[model samples]
Target: MEAQHTPDEKIVKIEKTILRGTRPRSIGYNARKGTHGPCITDVVVRLHTDSGAWGIGPANISQEKAKGLLGSKINEIFKLPFGAFGEGIKLDLPLWDLTARILNLPLYRLLGARGKRDVQLYDASIYIDDLNLNDRQAVSLFKEEVYSGIEHGYHNFKIKVGRGSRWMEPKEGIRRDALVVRTVRETSPAGSKIMIDANMGGTLNSTLELIRLCAEYDLYWFEEPFAEDKLLNLALKSHLIDSDSKLLIADGEFHPPNYFFELVEEGLVDVVQHDFSDYGITWWRSTAAKLESWDALCAPHTWGSYIERYHHAHFAASIPNYALLEASPGKMPGIIEDGWEMKNSRLHVPNTPGAGITIEKKIFDQGLDDRSAFSLSI
Candidate 1:
């Protein structure tokens, strides 16, 4: 039998565009960080082929590097199952999108459709909104946020804890952290999943105390209670076991060190949360395989870009060991996304080809107005 032939399409042009994202509400302080303003900007790179097929995704490479790929063939730069190779690895997202569109398959299907299409998602916007309020007011705000998430079809909420690390007195901070967790638990619907993130702002003793205070609330996970340390994480894991708490220990978001995987290998961490956009899909694909063997779950971080959130959704649909995705509900102007809907606390991954999103022409034109976009052609 003759070998199967593939498309000989060459990348004709590449364009880099900027998109502005706005959150529904202004994000407040976290364990260690200050207010996250209401808006953020994302830079995305789009690849156009001579065959009229194109793909787009979050951009991380320099314009010079992108220019070097101007004349590369689609098949030469990207392949199925293994994805982009060598220099093409920098263009992972766009290449994957382009290849999937060429195959007429959705991104997840192109990745083998190893998991379900309706991926579970959790609201990741619950921050420390109680910094300036009284106990009653703080609780009231927390309740309002929970109700809002429920209204928006999100049943899982991740609350930012560890107020004592920076804002208030140590004792008072722990007290407020417990208060916020309890308020969310009391206000949300039954069976709502609650997770808390400390952003590595607490010490081991303080973390343990906070956990004890919220013991009856049934948290889904304790994220970054402190930095990732072998002894500290091991002790925390032991305490959870000793107390018979079901809360999972999660870390690795803050530029995880080299020994991070060793922590997973020893069963100290229950969930792995490397940032999806920073690490890209190719890394996650390989990392997820390793985590699967180690009996750990993957829930890649999706905090800033709504575009990256979709990337994580497709990844979740393609991986069997994925935990729920972190959702930051908002609007991304200039982007036309289709087939993505939230129902019953789950975000349905679109069956459309190439990430299920297209750039609006008007928005694309406006982005080009400033002449900041980089473009290259044959």
Candidate 2:
């Protein structure tokens, strides 16, 4: 008879680091978000096992809430239902990292993914409501940003439309949205892909108008044309739009699995944008597999700092259906140890185990000096 060996580790500590930084100069305005040039405020989390192995993840969770894990065996923790403490994806990430490290495997491999050395990435520029620029000026600025992205070898680009923020009038917003697409299509290299995100910012009427306008430029996709609740409307709009134009919608982020799978089963959107920070490793792995079976594609939403970007890249590298990984590349540099650079418009996956990037201790130390910085320990 084979003897069973006892597992040696338990998750003993959980900590969250709050960091404040400036936005990258390249980022533009979102009328819906109503910010000119906003400062960055985000949280990074860490989990320590009894055996001295540790794992790190992003997204914020309350320290008191995480204390529920204290004194629990590792397996017990894993067996608990997701979001049991209302912590959501923030808790799942560190736990997955811990499990992978304990098994001496990379996070992606543990999730049954064969990591790709290079994953194609997209530059998210060309904000339609830059508050600072008029229609013509916005177009010119967008052209410049697109050229800069091309210079960096990025062939896929995303632009935000439905501008009429607090700054621009409704009529001006519509004009700018049309101009943004035309400008990018005209300026990009041959075969460059252009994607526009409405962010649920446009009315159904205006969104359909933009969809009609977008067909002329051969747009790659239209994102979140309406709200998440308007699934039927989105499906109808998808049918009404040019067959060539894809509808990209983000769902199943920071929520349970039921709705995410439902969206896929209903065929509401052509492309589903999944944010790992919101879905965590385990849930995301299952969702990705379902997407594959359903013939749907996933593009990871990368809106965080370098560490989070690396996490998204690793996930993208593992999945064959993903054609583009969203990238922000915000202002803070040297926050992570893995020298992240775009080569031929793609990021090379980190070969290390777990999430594959080391947080810069000095950066964390500096963050501690900020008034907003705080840590939770148990």
C-alpha lDDT score of every prediction, in listed order: 0.85, 0.65
State candidate 2's TM-score: 0.82
State which candidate has the highest TM-score.
1
RMSD of 2: 4.2
Residues 1-378 of candidate 1 have per-residue lDDT tens digits of 122234569999988877777877899999888999788677788898998999888877777898888889977877657777778888888888888788777888777678888988899999988888999999888888888888778888999998999999999999999999999899988898889999999999999999999999989999999988899989999998998888898988997878999999999998999988777788889999999999999988878777776767888899899988988667888778878887989889998986888889888766655456776787
Q: Which stretches of candidate 1 lie over 4 Å from their true place?
A: 1-8, 370-372
Q: Each model's TM-score?
A: 0.95, 0.82
Per-residue CA lDDT of model 2 for 101-219, tens digit only, reads 66666655555565475877787755644566666787777787788778766778888877753446777777778788888889987887788887767666777667776668877
Instruction: Indicate which candidate wins on lDDT.
Output: 1
Model 2 local distance difference test score: 0.65
